[model samples]
Target chain A: MTLHAIDLSVSRGGVAVLEGLNFSLSPGTALVLRGPNGSGKTTLLRTVAGLQPPLAGRVEGGGEEIAYAAHADGLKAMLSVSENLSFWASVFGTGDIVAALRAFDLEALSDRLAGTLSAGQKRRLGLARLMVTGRAIWVLDEPTVSLDAASVELFAAAVRTHLGQGGSALIATHIDLGLDTELLDVTPFRAVWRASDPDEAFL
Target chain B: MIALLTRDLRLGVRAGGGFGLGLAFFLIVTVLVPFSIGPESALLARIAPGILWLGALLACLLSLDRILALDWEDGSLDLLATAPLPMEGIVSIKALAHWITTGLPLVLVAPALGVLLNLPGPGYLWVTASLLLGTPALSVIGTFGAALTVGIKRGGLLLSLLVLPLYVPTLIFGAEVARRGAAGLEVVTPLTMLAGITFGVIALLPFASAAVLRINLR
Candidate 1:
């Protein structure tokens, strides 16, 4: 499957942020989104993920195939690591979280409550949830937050394995994961504000 | 669908998850009313049906924020929206889960609470039956209200505000059925109206809730 965004314009709180942006990611490849703060990186990713509709253009082949992972880890504090993963697994209609558990080196902490894990560990568990999603396109927003170097490598390896198996990822991150991925700089697509527009005055 | 239901049920039962909180509130309301009324059996019996219905409605309202706020805070709602499941299915399952956790308990323990209020014998079956038919609508309507104010922080107050007006018809029919059944009056009219509201909301409000949720997600 290929995820394509054509002439996509997205807004944040009713103001245009990114306009006329275009990108495509085929199977077995990855696209890394690069931009500065308040540059609509999150907005663009969300638009493609179908969390919010596009202002003008439509996203092709991205809705059902996309599994979004935002800054929030989406883990239940009370459920154990395995239980949390299993619940998402069942939700995504997949079974056998053993591979997911082993991918993130979470087998040891499988029985522990998610709340008890360290920050990095919690982020790891959150990233581990993607493995159970079984979707082709991953729409991740700063997925490496709170991760140490080794854990970043773990995440990098997981993405590599996913890409090797014909999956794609559209990640918004600052640090490079040392993966063979394409970089799409969003600075050019920044929607310029006009003096005549009333909305831009408040912005 | 069952997976979501079971997960919510498990979360509700977990410590500090607010499972029994509504039931406890209902109990307190039922128990406190008599003390204020001076233990007069006649007045208590006369008011038991209305009191129980109001108690159930408030208890359901109290827990309304829990339906989607937790998931919204943790970004589970976003992910669930992107999942293969339809938004309608997600909201329906959520309402079903809330009914099971909060509304179902209030129904079961309502009769027991009625005993404390000196409720007449016939009121037990009618109250329970009315709650059984009515609480699902409460859950579904509360789901809509919760979805409406989900984006706002501290939305519980606004949720109640948006939901209580919608609850009027259900409350009227529900309380009427209970009151008339307690008095041994014919109840087919209010009973059917209660069922109508329940079925109508159950059939339609999920779409409205789903649409509101999508807008909130936006």
Candidate 2:
């Protein structure tokens, strides 16, 4: 499946941040979104993931089979690693969390509560959720935040494997993951602040 | 849906999930009511049904924020929104989990507390019956309130402000059923109205809640 965002415009707090943004992700490919903080990269990824609608334009091929991993891990601290993976796996109607655990190198910590894991371990658990989702397009925002060098490599390998299996990923990151992927800098699509608007008064 | 419900139930049972909080609040409020009003059996019995209803309502409210705030904070809502299940199903399951973990307990334990209130013998069954029929609405409607104020910081006050008015109808009909049953009057009318409210909210509020959650997610 090819995810397309054509002439997309996204807003934050009722103000347009990125405008006329166009992008597409073909199968077995990766797109790295690059922009400074507050540049609407997150907003754009969110729009493409269908979490929130775009102010204008539409995202084609996002109805189903798209998994979004926000900065937060979304893990239940009370649930162990395997339990958290199983919850998401069941939620996405996928089967077998063993591969996800092994892929993220979380097999050793499978029985430990998510709250008990270190920051990097928790992040791995979060990223492993993508594998359990069985989704074609993985929309990840700053997925490598707390990961160390080896863990980043683990995440990169997981993404590579996902792409090799004809899956696609849209990632926003400042660090290079050393992958054959396309880089999209959203700086060009930054929307100018419009001074005159009816809703501006409310702000 | 069952998976979500089970996960929520597990979370509620775990430490710091606020599962015990609502029940504890209900018990404390029920125990304090008689002390505040003085121990006159007639007065206590006369007002017991309403006090119990109020206590249940407030107790439900106490756990309302837990319905979505934790999910929202931990970013579970975002992932769940993108899951295969519809948003309506997600909110509905959350409401069901809340009702099971919070509302159902209050219903079961109300009779025990009714003794403390000197509730008339006839009032016991009616109170339980009314609560059994009514707390589902409280959970459903409170889910909407939680979704509505989910974006606000420290929105507990705002949440209560949004939900208390909605609870008025449920509270009135529910208390009326118990009060009428206690007085040996016909309980059919109020009981019917309470059932209507519960079924109506349970059937419709999930849509509104899902919509509000989508907006908040934006």
lDDT of 1 by residue, B88-146 (tens): 99999999999999999999999999999999999999999999999999999999999
Model 2 chain B poorest ten-residue lDDT run: B73-82
Cα distance off (Å), candidate 1, residue A89: 0.7
lDDT of 1 at B111: 94
Model 2: lDDT equals 0.93
Each candidate's TM vs. the true structure? 0.97, 0.98
Chain B TM-score of all predictions, in order?
0.99, 0.98
Considering summed lDDT, which 10 consecutive residues are worst modelled in model 1 chain B?
A: B75-84
lDDT of 2 by residue, A95-181 (tens): 899999999999989999999999999999999999999999999999999999999999999999999999999999999999999
DockQ scores for all the models shown?
0.82, 0.88
